[model samples]
Target: MLATPIYIICSPCPQVGKTLIARLVCEFLLLKNGTAASFDVSLKEPSLLDYLPHITETADVIDTYGKMQLMDPLIFHDRVAKVIDLGFHAFDEFFKMCEEIGFMKETVRRYVTPIILFVAGSDRSSWRSYEMLQRQIPPGALVIIHNEFALRGGLPEAMVGEHVIRIPALPAFLKFYVDRLSFSFTGYLRDEKDWSTELHQWIRRNYTMIRDLELRVMGRQSYKPTAPCGRPRWHER
Candidate 1:
């Protein structure tokens, strides 16, 4: 059996498709394993819980009770895959609590890998936050996400060789349908007749990338090395 994964989809900047990626990961887990859960730590409207309320619970790290509620299940040895849609507002507090309590050490001991899918932004704050995460989390546990629509410019030279998962830009025609909370990626794959549509291809691309991420995390592949130059070395799914 694959090791249980706790995917924390986070970014210090809003509207960077962090929640969208979280939704995808949650749905992917549900379809792959038939059991999955998610935590919605966002203050934004149309968050992960909005899209997947049945499997998602609202979480907060601002106080002791809330922090325990959120972190306790994470250390469990159950095989259920967990996804956390962490928002910009809760980023600092959530990670601070993690560090304070030796969260990573506990998860490692439990055989539950905690992977941070950090959505990259062009701002300096985002860069600094990424750097801080590098220091706080193990290199293999930290994966950079590049949402094509969210990043206004290329990543800094410093981020060239990081383990990256890229979210492709959704075509204009498919965006309207996907924006609806009622739309489900797994449902579409099961029910859609034509598999050649842009939406189908887009969803498959993301699902493939996520599956590849899982395999790599399972130690089937080695972590990435520095790219030649200029080009960012993204993990090929």
Candidate 2:
């Protein structure tokens, strides 16, 4: 059986569409597994919680109390897929906690897989953050996200990961319609009326990409996480 998936959608740079990806993944998982939950660690408005309030809860990991509230539930393999929309502000602290508490090993032992869907950017911060995660998390668990809207110049080879998931940019005209909190990707798909529309086609392409990503993660060989030797100086740069 495949391990329960915990999709952590994160980016070290702000306003890079991290929450948009999280909303899509949460909706995708809900459709695929019939049950899914999400956490919004963002301080920005109109985050995952705002977009998918039914299944998303506000999360904070700044302090030990907040960390416990977030990590405790995730440590359990409840069989329900999870998605975390981690804000750029908490990016470093979140992973630091994971390393300190042996989170990767514990998750592996509990039949839970934690995959980091890192949004790729050309910024030095983005590049360095990706490099640091390579040492801290299993390579197989780090998936690069090529968000066309965010990175119009295209993906940098150095920032690429073992696995890549692309999010095609939607035309500005159509993007405005989907940005509304009331809008729903899955709901739009279910409506046969919009099947021939551009928005519908765009959503279909993204859903297909997400579906393929899940299958690949499931079929990939299992990984055993080892203790991180020491923190990388990537942050010092």
lDDT tens digits by residue: candidate 2, 51-127 = 88888888898777788778877866688998999999999999988887888877877778888899987788998
The estimated TM-scores of all candidates read 0.90, 0.90
126 in model 1: Cα distance from truth in Å?
Answer: 0.6
In the order shown, the candidates' Cα RMSDs to the true structure are 9.3, 5.4
Model 1 RMSD vs true structure: 9.3
Clashing pairs in 2: none
- Model 2 clash tally? 0
Candidate 1: deviation at residue 198, Å? Answer: 1.0
